[model samples]
Target: MDNNRLATKPHYQILDGLRGVAAIIVVFFHLAEPLASNHLDNIVNHGYLAVDFFFLLSGYVIGYAYDDRWHTFTVAGFLRRRFERLQPLVVLGMTLGAIGFYFTDSTIWPLIHTVPLWKLLVVLLIGYTVLPVPLSMDIRGWQEMHPLNSVAWSLFFEYIANILYAIGIRKLSTKALACFVVLAAAVLLHFAVTNANGDVTGGWTLNFEHMRVGITRTIFPFFAGLLLCRVTKPVYIKHAFLWCSLLVAVVLFMPRIGGATHLWANGLYESFCIIIVFPLIVYIGAGGVVHSKTESKICTFFGKLSYPLYITHYVLVYFYVAWISNHNGITLKQAWPYALLTLAGTIVLAYASLKLFDEPVRAWLRKKLK
Candidate 1:
């Protein structure tokens, strides 16, 4: 019966492949630290935009997977599924980070206290919804803003979006129109806040401290994704111009828009993401770019492991670099080897988590809950 049920379900391999792509981009973006020094920061800095891609993708996938079930959106079921999907790997990552911190020097005990037993207890019990502080002490140093459980920050909004969906907010209209309105409001709010703040200096105020602000900015993009699920037009005709126009806008306007520009930039950027970038992703998925029998095997493997890869890669990168710096004279020029090492280690760890942790727990949850 379970096998039959699984067979009947829609399998969006393209979305899985997209997850693989997003995870890889994030890893490479961090890799830039070891590879590019001040000379190439601008070129590589843009890779952070991959997070936006993940956000957009999440919006689409959630909508695609659950739109028909909008009437069934229930708080208990929503939280249960979300908690099952997200918590295993998150807890694993946090636990690993806490253990790593505990084993470090005693002089750093106060900092370790930041992620101490009590905090771990809180995270395990309450699911770590509180804001995370930066992980490293040296604010001016290379990994200044690093946090132990940094990647989980985005999951906060992901969960919020899910909660909103589950609570029957999505049944107000056709999913597409609902998404359009929400996205529009987010963009407008972002612009209003930015202008009111007198055109601030950094990228959109989209980091951890301003999480609520970030969630507001992203809601529209996510809903835009939901709309994509209902899109039936041919991708080439539907999205090509959108992509071209947005690409042109980003290239032409991003530089001139100037410092602390996440507000204006995110609004335009998300528009492009929704109208242009996301469609391209869907096109790639629909095109069977990774759907050959051999490719399917590879994609399935990576797809299954992608979540852990996304969560753990950054933590590994930070710790690997820290350990390396403590032992030897490593420089940015020597980043390739370290990057490769980090990738290899992360992949191994991710695979282990998938097999030993994620899959088992997920199966257990399904059986016990269902």
Candidate 2:
């Protein structure tokens, strides 16, 4: 979610900066993913949780920006505003994926060379709308919602949450909202703890199980974030950005808990982080003030970079993963240089997308809609 949506509202500088931090870690997480045999041993073990953090942030920012505007804001208006903020980059990201798809052929994607140009175009067109394609239409081997740009799966779920919020969830009494959040949290906990892998991953596919995972991941965090914004009082916290950013990084960087024998242990840990630690971080981040010139500039830069970086970076990751898969037995040591390049390249691209496409396009849409 773009805090740019809060143009006239008070911005949570630290939350934006923290989002930037999480976005960057996600890049490294993907980079290191090819190195691991499974989620258990991935060097960036808990990095997938960043999606949950994003859901929470999205909810909080939506509530902060729109909760009081219900008198003037219709559901259509709210959804329009959200689509304006979110869809532009989604289009750009998927386009980038389509452009790179054939070029990134590797042993991992044996069918990449076989995919016809017309089918590629078809998938690209669907991806542009950020809607999930059925498995039968999967261009890539992975049964991803947006095979061209895998990250769009999360965006799809987010849109679902957004629609739900606009239609009815926004009208819930405060007590009712809290009860809903509680029930949602319980479902999330059960889903996480009972899973075979002990982590809340795998929502990319468009199946009943994956759909359940996607919905489960979305509801509690988004509404809990909404609840937080409505009820929490912000007390000034010194160095809140630094403290909160560090806290987020530490949780994401933590090694996987309880090896194969006790998958539920890792699941419990992830649930704890999502349900408890994430809200506390948001509370502190919301309460924070930029202390100095350097801090202010850092917050502004990071806040602007966060969403674009997240949405667009995965296109490059498709190539990076392809490169790694083509080269078998390539150690982390050997891959760091290329990984670093992908990181730097994606950051540069994300910044450019922010300045060139996202801001200009959003400004144009705002004027047109106004």
Show where candidate 1 strays beyond 4 Å.
Answer: 1-8, 34-43, 70-73, 103-110, 113-147, 175-179, 182-209, 233-271, 287-291, 323-330
Candidate 2 TM-score over all chains jointly: 0.97
lDDT of 2 by residue, 1-370 (tens): 3333444787888888888999999998999899998778889999999999999999999999899878765787788888889999999999899999988878888878888999999999998888899998888888888999888899999999999999999999999999999999999999999987788998899899899999999999999999999999988989999999999999999999998989999999999999999999999999999899999889889889999999999989988998999999999999999999999999999999999999999899887765
Residue by residue across 218-278, what tens digits does model 1's lDDT show? 5655666666665644243333323333442343223322235444554454345445665
> By how many angstroms RMSD does model 1 differ from the true structure?
6.2
Q: After superposition, how far is residue 154 of candidate 2 from its true place, in Å?
A: 0.7
TM-score versus the correct structure, for each prediction: 0.73, 0.97
RMSD of each: 6.2, 2.3
Minimal lDDT window, size 10, model 1: 137-146
Top of the candidates by TM-score: 2
What are the per-model numbers of colliding residue pairs? 8, 0
